[model samples]
Target chain A: MRTTLCDRLGIEYPVFGFTPSEHVAAAISRAGGLGVLGCVRFNDPEELDRVLDWMDDNTGGRPYGVDVVMPAAVPAEGSAGDLGELIPAEHRAFVERTLAELGVPELPDGAAERGGVLGWLHSVARSHVDVALNHRIALIANALGSPPVDVIERAHAHDVPVAALAGRVDHAMRHVDNGVDLVVSQGYEAGGHTGEIASMVLLPEIVDAVGERAPVLAAGGIGSGRQAAAALALGASGVWMGSFWLATEEYRRGMAEASAMQDALVAARSADTVRTRIYTGKPARLLRTRWTEAWSAPDAPAPLPMPLQNLLVAEAHQRISAAGDPSVVSMPVGQIVGRMDRVRPVADIMGELVADFASTVDRLGTLR
Target chain B: MRTTLCDRLGIEYPVFGFTPSEHVAAAISRAGGLGVLGCVRFNDPEELDRVLDWMDDNTGGRPYGVDVVMPAAVPAEGSAGDLGELIPAEHRAFVERTLAELGVPELPDGAAERGGVLGWLHSVARSHVDVALNHRIALIANALGSPPVDVIERAHAHDVPVAALAGRVDHAMRHVDNGVDLVVSQGYEAGGHTGEIASMVLLPEIVDAVGERAPVLAAGGIGSGRQAAAALALGASGVWMGSFWLATEEYRRGMAEASAMQDALVAARSADTVRTRIYTGKPARLLRTRWTEAWSAPDAPAPLPMPLQNLLVAEAHQRISAAGDPSVVSMPVGQIVGRMDRVRPVADIMGELVADFASTVDRLGTLR
Candidate 1:
């Protein structure tokens, strides 16, 4: 169980949990798995430093990682100029007008309302990466795209491994070419935004594509050890989970929120968790909520381009965040929701998955 | 395209292509759109006489249908049987000895020679429904699971429409309970044996499971015109294809196997298809040639379950009927293979499909 991955990240079980919550990262690492803090939401670099310090203090020497968005296909080269100059005025107007028409209320006090979408994401994520790489981070993962060449070089300079998330073979290929140490094949089942491919097929393809160059981690929609095993069977060396930890005791979301997640009947076949630009203006797969419903209306303005989309909805997201409304809030999880019937401790879940995987492999052995 | 499919039998699109090959069914119907032939490989009562005769003689009537095996799940309820009663003492001994020893010739053409791993599939698929129904057969579909019950009832009762081929979703709900027009959410790529689930994601969660309703036509790894449009965006009225046809002057395998099929470099990664038990004694997915070496080793009798794992080296499978050299055989057509690069008589393909389906649907659509 602690074989290959342990050698790579130098962790016990090959479970890397991605979360915005530092508590989760600490808890998982303490529980024998590495929990990487997803850095997109943290705007202040110092906040990241503080969070890392907290994780270090809490995890008691258990190693952890930091994940940021380093997509391989971001605003390609020159087009990235200003990111604003790149978007059409018409598109911008449409997005603004749609918000005006929707009467989405204004943001409350103390909100840092200045530099729009791209500005925020760049400042926050890039800064977090810089801070984490400077700290005791064991790994740095790029969520959206491949890490900029400099980021990879710098991380390498520090002896920290760099990982990236991929939804397709081509995406994974680019990351590998860019020299990612590991490629986390994230399927549609995981929370947040995801590729259309399911875990069953995407894993093997990525594993094959990576060949012997880099280790591969299976991510998205994995809520159980049985699934973790399936990923291994498909050739992934470890499991990267995001949604499974949503219910852990350390998960600080409100009580009602956690209860809804556990008790609600979200069938796998409902219209689908859309890969819409409702969130960061980037394509993301989240639960279809009333907020998303409003934007999807035929009459509503098409979601603004990345950053812009996030800009328009930022306040709404913040309000939901402050208010803790599950009905209209987006919950990122994968298709693996089908198996998340109840909540359990991080250790228990990890142990069960390991045990189940062993049993399943044995079952498959019997077939042979 | 004047291969009138429906007028005689009665349905609509006339795009029938859902079988593993059924004698002359494809040739007969591909001449127009009237008949589609899959599962003719079952070689039972329906094959030798009824299906073949119908395929050869059907006029500009309608699209006829064909169906092969595509499972919503591994070990689909009826897809493969325990065959516990069928396995001869020697076969069991061979299976045991294979694993007990190092490399034993994959399942020794077990005593009965009566049934290979896919042995029960046809009978299970005999789902006479693929053979029943007709109403202009605009399109003949394969209800991969039990071929839609209503198809049989409606086709028989009204003398119109019946279909098969739907790889995932609640097959019981879609093909068994609902009244379908056609349903085959084949993967993104595949030649034979599918269902790891990847029309990226469409194939599995396809909206096919309302029960006793809808005809399903799932063809994976298709290589052709408007296929992406027809299946992904448009929800195909017809499943136009490219694999078997690629081998055909009239069609296009379009992707990897378009030329040498079993002997292409693309076949290595492409041929490790699942939907096991189709050709093998057990269900498994192995590289067309390279990956399967271990299975065929003289002492390694170990194979996967029914159709798949066994599909590679099952001694008794007519598996080599298509590839010839059992050890080097390859079956690489899949949904993603739609990327294959070629074209054939889409018209002949379309014509027969519509023609047979028209007749099939006309015969069945009219049912009470």
Candidate 2:
């Protein structure tokens, strides 16, 4: 499983796992793969600092990375209060009405707010970069687009490589032009915000366009060892996987949200997902639930762009989730969710990936 | 370059080329690859018979296949006149107005209607099957969906293997259940009618779902040897290529329509294509052009269903192509068009694919 990318990153395998749970991140790194902790969910700087400290301690000197959502085009400037004000009355009414229709109860008077929208803003993302840079992070990846030039320079100053996710060749080229150390070619089957191209086409296009400048990582719909081998054969340096980690024991044990999502994911198939903007005001692939369908109704207003969309649904999602309604929970996942049937340890998952990749390569060798 | 599938099909390389031109098909078979002639353009059974005879005579006893678009679910029963009447006047007006606005000249009197829509109907597609089975075709492929059970049985009785193009895992499974000998997993990046799933996700899913029952062919976005190697690594028995042959000299010399489409395809990038229902009523990836954009405008009527939509635009497409206006032409192509920069012979393309596959396999072998 050793490739140039594995050597550059000092990992035993070229598998890069992305998740929001620090325990899962630490476990993956300790298991010989590079684990990237997603920082977008940690709106509080202090909490992010604590998570990084925990990751640093538990990784036992194994290298890990941090991922932040830094978009090339930021939405209009606004405070949380200002953005909340942008939600239309009808949209608010629609959310409340749909929750009531679904028999979802409201949160208790003193219940903690579970969803936050501030992290999606550019200012907060830049702060994430600051916190990540202060740690022993070996990589800093912009989840949405190319990290700002200043952010890239700061990471380079710390001798940390910078990576960005691109769905098209032009976007990958833009990242290369802006001095990104790596480009993750994400296909439409990937979870969260994605462009229309698929990985089989997008990976090779980006690889050919910018493989000379920097290595490209293949993402979206990759879950097993054979997929990792296929990614390498398509000219990608490694595989960046996310949804596969959701089925891991470490992730489910560390986060309650993962447990809730696992129940739905186990029952889902590849056709059970739909790409809609109801979750974050961007086209994200999520399990097809009543929540997504309600927003897709003919009478529903167009989803607001970016931060405003995330803001409008934050409270509604909190209430629904707090009520323990699995039917309406927002589970951001990819088409690969169909293959995630059971929970296993990070070590076991990593072992299977390396073994499967080796066997696939051997099988290819048998081809005349 | 050889695999069990190649041995089963008696082909030199596990490459299957799909094209509409008989000359191109024969050329590919003569060049040591299996060439499947697409028969959807032949609305007349006699014309299809003549073409199949030509392929049989031109290829020096080499094996070839025939492709027909026999959809599993035929549209609501109706004659050509009944379906024609179902098309709204406003839709017809929109096509004419858009073509005139683009300055496409009308076809000359008796200009031999360059395009036809009858082939998309179920009856015409069945006729295509009847014409093909009478010849010595090694394979019979359904381009749209699983062939009717009777069609599959008939093909089997003739000692010809049946294959179907599936864009989803469930669809592939269904094809296997209906007794298909092979499944071609096509992704969204493919030209013509395609589902939303990308090849990276779709290929492995189909392979895992039906590899035991049927050999799976990776389709969509494959144009080179490295991709072929990657597809095999992902568990495909072979590769089914379409758009790559459009740039070949054989296809260009064989069909005038191929020549018209080549101009737009050579200039297209991966992002330059759009999946729209304007051309075929089914969502098909086409080179983004004024013809597509006009129908997408706010005032444009909703595209009619299946045969109706194909009927509405067939004459307009004929007129546009007759004018030799590449900007407004309807060219069905895949994202791989970005890599097809020049014309080459069938032999050279096959040789390059073989060489690239071998070198990629060698490179993968170097990974420790």
Candidate 3:
């Protein structure tokens, strides 16, 4: 289960867990894998700073990382309030109508309106980078692609390596050329935003294209140790997993609504997912639910681009989560949802993955 | 590398090579892997009989298999002319217009017209099965799913095993329940008709569901020994590879139009493909070319259902191939196209796969 990436990232195993919950990330770090906290959910820098402070004290001295969304082109800079105004009225009405039709209840009075998502904005993502560099973080990753060159230099200045997620070979090569220290070959079957290439093909292509320059971590459809071993066999330095952690006990503890999402994921098979841009204006694999199915209708309005789409749907998403219906909840998950049959402690999952990886390797050794 | 499937199928290795060319199938069988010749192209039973005779004599007494397209619901039985009339005039005109736009010249005078593919008719497929059973075929596989129980029993009566391709766990379970002896868990990244699950997730799901009842062979995005090793790690008894053999020297030697297809495939990246129903009535992965692009236009007619769609495009495909332009050639290929950079003998490919599998296993064994 060891590779040069393990030594370089100062982790015991080659597993890198990505989650939005600081609790889950800290638990993963404590469990000997690098737990990367996704910072895209934090709309405020102070909020991210507070979370990082908590992460620093709770990780048991293990290294962890932070992920931010930095689009290749810096989008039009605006506050969430201004971004909300840019969303078309028809799109907003469609979202509201769809939510109401799906029987999603409105938020309670005096609750915060989760309307706009400024987290995907370039300025906010830059703030995330600045805050992440201030912490004792071991790595910083850009979810979209390679961050700007100066950002890489700034991370390097903090002695923190920068990683980028790539779905194609040219993207990996471009990431390396732009000074990224590591490449995460995120496949088409990955949750959130993804490229069209599957991990089995994209991993080897990217590894051969960029492994000489930077270590390649395979992502997408990887839940078990056998899949992790496959990643290694395909020349990935490790596995970058996100969906499996969504079902972790730590995840359940942080997000009150995650139980319903976990139930949805646990009940889903590998084929019960669709890649649609309705999630965030970019194609993302999400569990096939009533919400996603509604958008597939012929008359449904097309999703807005990027930050606007997130802004338009943020409140609807809040309602869906608050409604707590597993069948209609909007959740991004990989096809590996079939394997996340139950919730377990992060340590137990990590132990099982490592054990299974070792046994799988041993089993393969007997083939000839 | 070997598994129980190797012994059961009477092959030296667990590799299952699938191709439409008898030359390539014989070469694969002679090289120690089980070569399964695709029979859907043989509209005439006599033509298929001739090929089987060639395979029997050319395979050096090695075991081989035959694949037929016996759809679960038998398609309408008709002569090619009867079915040809059922296609809408707009669809036919669109095909002709597309060919004209692509500068694909019509067939020369006295040349055979390749339109109206009766091979997809249920009667033709049943005839293929009848002919294959009379030969020394070691296995019979259904490309669609589990053949009718009678078809399975018919093969079993001859002591030959029946294998079916499945993309989901339930499908694999159903296949096994229907008396299929082997299940090929073909993934989303596979060529031709495929399901939505990627190989990494689908392989393990199917293997776990049906491995106790039948062996599972992983198919999709597998081109090299490393991917085959990964499939074994994922619990697949063997690798059912089709796309990799498309670039072999034997493949090049058989079809005069194959060179353009190979050139298109060799120049393609993993992302240079689209899953569309234009090629067949069911969704299939095809190399993204002008032909596919033309069909994707907003005003283009929707592809007809399976056998009808193939009939509609048969002549267009023929003209495109005869035009000998790689850029417009319509070809079915998996995402592994990026790995097929050159032509090689089937023996060379098999040797490389075995050597790589051994070295990959050995490499993983030393990782701890």
Highest DockQ scorer: 3
Off by over 4 Å in 1: A72-123, A188-190, A196-198, A253-271, B1-20, B23-335, B338-368
RMSD of each: 20.0, 1.6, 1.1
**What is each predicted model's overall lDDT from 0 to 1?**
0.54, 0.86, 0.90
Pairwise TM-score winner, candidates 1 and 2: 2
Rounded to one decimal, what is candidate 3's iRMSD? Answer: 0.8
The candidate scoring highest on lDDT is 3
Off by over 4 Å in 3: none
**Candidate 1 local lDDT, B37-116, one digit each (tens):** 55434535444346546554644443455444544344533332454444446545654453334322343354333344
Residue-level lDDT of model 3, residues A1-368, one tens digit each, is 88987788899998999999999999999999999999988888999999999999999999999999999878878877887788889998889899989999999999898566777888889999989888999989899999999999999988999999998889899999999999999988898899888888999889888857899999998999999999999988889999999888899775888878889988987888899999889899999999999999997999889978888888888988999999997999899988989988999999999999999999998896
| DockQ of each candidate, alpha-carbon based | 0.03, 0.74, 0.85
**Candidate 2's residue-wise lDDT over B181-269, tens digit each?**
99999988899888888787788889988968999999988988889988999999999999888888887674576666778878778
Predicted complex 3: CAPRI docking category: high
